[model samples]
Target chain A: MGLVPRVVVDVMPKPEILDPQGKAVLGALPRLGFSGVTEVRQGKRFELQVEGEVTEAVLADVHRMAEMLLSNPVIENFEVRVEETA
Target chain B: MGLVPRVVVDVMPKPEILDPQGKAVLGALPRLGFSGVTEVRQGKRFELQVEGEVTEAVLADVHRMAEMLLSNPVIENFEVRVEETA
Candidate 1:
């Protein structure tokens, strides 16, 4: 067996897009009997499982992928968290 | 005007799903003379912009929304980071 590396990617609105979904859901909140919510916007997330030993070098390569291929720096930012399974 | 709150949502692989897209991209690496990458997986990310004063209480409502509608608990998880803009 080998150690697996996983990376979590989070993407969000740039604060420019009119969040209709967020608003629609927010408007429905009171009807749902949940009046606590005031405003809502939704985001997307990604999970990746990698192979090989967990090392900073390995992670850097993954980070490069996130920056280059996986995530867009213009409207999104991402952080990588490695899971333990040895 | 009020401070706008934003949450960055990241979703990724469960480590169980066979990541074909990730693999296809990885397999193409060597052709580009980039032999470093061996395996890869893809994921989705979301960005949300919220309205109102950014406070712990306000964020609590937003957090609850994430748990309720924005994300799935099984095979998925989320984290909240509020942006500051006054």
Candidate 2:
């Protein structure tokens, strides 16, 4: 069997969507003396240990998975990065 | 003034921490026809639009911010990547 690959998927809320979490962080930054942080958007990241190789087909499958499970298609956008960790 | 830099920070739960969200995704994958996904770890990503250049000092500042506010240092780890967007 081929070595399993590691995948990192980042899911972010759409620019127009309201992100309370992000806003909360932005609010807290200045208190921590992290000034000049104009804006912040909080999102989700999924790190997957897959039972297969990193291939175009596998990436497509993962993308589908992201669209179907990892993110809300209407309000979120996701990016998939595949790595051959094994 | 230097161009604003976009910084991406990824925060992940410690390997041993129990991640209910990750478990939820793993469970839902198969039902969505995405089999062979042995494991999944759910985490958070922060996209920051900073009013500064992407420099080492800026990265270090972001790292400090991550430790102080972006993550639970006791059970989470974070990485910061900076990119020039202007």
Candidate 3:
């Protein structure tokens, strides 16, 4: 087996949507003595090791997967980053 | 009110720990026609907008926060990236 393709998918809630987890963190920052922390947004990151080259086709497939399963398009947005692991 | 610092905190389960979410994603990939997806690791990313400069002291404080509140040291590892939002 050769080196695999690595991809990172960052999925975050849309700015207009309310992020309760982020809000909770923001609320607790000051209590934790992290007063400088003004805002916080919690999100998901998926590191995918694909069994192939990091070609355009692979990147497209990954993007499709991110949209279809990794995130909810209505209230969230996602970014796909293709890395050269080989 | 100068430029603020943007910090991205990434928290992921240690390699030895069980990641049921990642496993579920890996298992579903093939069925979803994503045969090339060999492995998947799901993690959390915290995007924090700090109300100060991205100084060394600020980075250190962020690291402390990550170790104490952002992640469970026994089960996961975390990374912190300091960015300029100026």
Candidate 4:
């Protein structure tokens, strides 16, 4: 591990929302000779390197960050967690 | 678990490459009152629903998909794994 710990935030579209990018990929799959994939959902992943240790307070702040900027609550859901460093 | 299994593919830019999007997010963070984050790297996460059981062969195919379409091998690296369903 480096001197700083890392936090991972994943922002994904809501299940009800349509993901055109994913649909495009799904359509292109079979054309590329890849099959058996029924659905594909594309999302964003963010890795943040924190200056200090990952405490509950920092995690809470990260959650708030996810809600306020990383994701649009109306159409997306966000998950925040600590990513173990190698 | 549902009738089908889900595979997760994460595509991230190589560490040596410049990530302008992530840099933009990092620049906007402090303006949004988010601090303590030294660095940020943004990537893509893909959730793929497979029609049948997720075997090693399926995983291999997913890896190939990641290499051929999901990511640009010249600048990005991808990881493919089965996502456990609830």
Q: Indicate the residue-level lDDT of A26 in model 1.
A: 70
Computed on C-alphas against the true complex, the DockQ of each candidate is: 0.30, 0.88, 0.85, 0.89
What tens digits encode model 3's per-residue C-alpha lDDT throughout A1-86? 55555799999999899999999988887788887888899999899987647778888999989988899999999999976655
lDDT of 1 by residue, A1-86 (tens): 56555555554555666667667777776665555444555544444455556568767766776677665768655667775546
Supply fnat for every model shown.
0.36, 0.96, 0.84, 0.84
Clashing pairs counted in every model: 21, 0, 0, 0
TM-score of chain A of 4: 0.93
lDDT of 2 by residue, A4-75 (tens): 568999999999999999999999998888887889999999999876467788788899999888999999
Tell me which of candidates 3 and 4 scores higher on TM-score: 4
What's the CA RMSD for each of the models?
Answer: 5.6, 2.6, 2.5, 1.6
Better of 3 and 4 by lDDT: 4
Task: Considering chain A alone, report the TM-score of candidate 2 relative to the true chain A.
Answer: 0.86
Winner on DockQ (1 vs 4): 4
lDDT of 4: 0.90
Top candidate, metric TM-score: 4
Q: What residue runs in model 1 are displaced by over 4 Å at the alpha carbon?
A: A1-4, A15-20, B1-68, B71-86
DockQ of 4: 0.89
Give the worst 10-residue stretch by lDDT in candidate 2 chain B.
B50-59
